[model samples]
Target chain A: MSISARNVFKGKVTELKEGPINAEVEITTSGGDKIVAMLTEGSVKSLGLGMGADAIAVVKTPWVTLLAGTPQYRFSARNMLHGTVSSFVKGAVNCQVNIMLPGGSPISAMVTNAAVADMNLTEGTPVVALFKASHVLVGVPV
Target chain B: MSISARNVFKGKVTELKEGPINAEVEITTSGGDKIVAMLTEGSVKSLGLGMGADAIAVVKTPWVTLLAGTPQYRFSARNMLHGTVSSFVKGAVNCQVNIMLPGGSPISAMVTNAAVADMNLTEGTPVVALFKASHVLVGVPV
Candidate 1:
């Protein structure tokens, strides 16, 4: 079978913080990049996930919002990956920007062509890729 | 400003098929992943995108569906990525499954915990992630 999502991180379950409605699970990749996900209490049990358990962090491409230059304000997003613009492409309505993290992981961001022009994003441009914890999905292998 | 989304792919506009109301835009990521998006003609014109334009493709996490094992019937979803269960975290209502494609990119799927149980997805389990092209939102940075 085939799927459409583009961003997938392989890591291990580092920690699990449970709440009434949601639970926080952190997965640290081999590269030491940490990804945080929010799940339901029932889900935490169903997956039977615990510390040092192998897991992966799933994120979709469109769900990633890109910010050019340094952020002037604090963001609610739990994950903010900083990188340099390695490359970009323009479509009819959107532009795909590739940011190479210091860890060598490539993060992708889809913005508007207008945004690209407005931000003056080019090669070597510093950018931040932001996403909320609620938007993150955690999975265990069967 | 920070927006909520997870998947962001940077690619080049390889094709643009225009329609009466909507247009088809194809973006080829640096990793050779071809992302297809359908946008209103007005959006196409507003982005001023043409051949060889750069763009990014965005997909939300909830929008992704994971299929375990082999598919018995064909699906209508245009994008299907195959990978092993890198890991997953279960939520109260949903479970997040991470599939690692042969391309080394990770695709995420959000399915119900019941579905994961029914499918028996586990580590190293082969799964397919699926999504519709219409679910894809094309954007340019502002």
Candidate 2:
């Protein structure tokens, strides 16, 4: 079977498997790549990635041919911020947001109870998450 | 305070996150660059990035500098047949192994439960993750 992968996927989450403290999502890509993404239990609930939920997966291949010859992720004085809410952790006060960056990587940030109430952040709310380039840690393979 | 960033932390995850889903980690570089990394509930434990945990982080400049350079990840068909395991995920009855090629990055393959039992796979165990250059998909930033 030929597996066609795209840079981004706009699809619905078909299945959600919740382990004791971990979770996995099955996303049916537009091109039909049954992509399975693992997330923390908190993230699963935070993002509300429930069955038949619509979501987007942005893939970044910085070293791949299309983006090759470009500088890899670098830290600088310039402010660089990017992330996507991949999952959620339901909290008594506020829910935690699991943010996935460009590199098929994920990060976690807490949304204050007030902030969540103010922004009314939910599964589909497109809230812009920001961070400095300095916040990113780059690692070369050994 | 100026932060000098470097890519030095590199290792396979031996554990994963526990509770709260999202936790923030600050890394003080040798040059005193306080790099902040987000740990998702799903990955925190698996990454073993606990207090004073050591790993390599690859740092480049301009973000595009690493992209404008030649492809850092390259693999030969023959070498793919005998590569090391860069990452793995255990399924109900089988396991998915992400083989680390000669260069950085990884390719994933599925192995049966028996194979995993026979190989006695562990976190640091090396197994070749192989794929063709043609398998790589490249694209411009959207």
Q: Which candidate leads the pack in DockQ?
A: 1
Predicted model with the maximum lDDT = 1
Candidate 2 error regions (>4 Å): A1-6, A30-32, A62-142, B1-25, B28-142
- Which stretches of candidate 1 lie above 4 Å from their native place? B1-62, B65-142
Task: Give the range of the ten consecutive residues with the poorest summed lDDT in model 1 chain B.
Answer: B69-78
Q: What is the C-alpha lDDT profile of model 1 across B16-131, one tens digit per residue?
A: 98766667788777677676776789999999878788777887766887766645434334566666888887655456677777765666676545457777778998887666
- For A43-116, candidate 1 gives per-residue lDDT tens digits of 67777878998876766656788887656889989888887999875666666677887776676766778988
Q: Give the clash count for model 2.
A: 47
By DockQ thresholds, what CAPRI class is model 1? incorrect
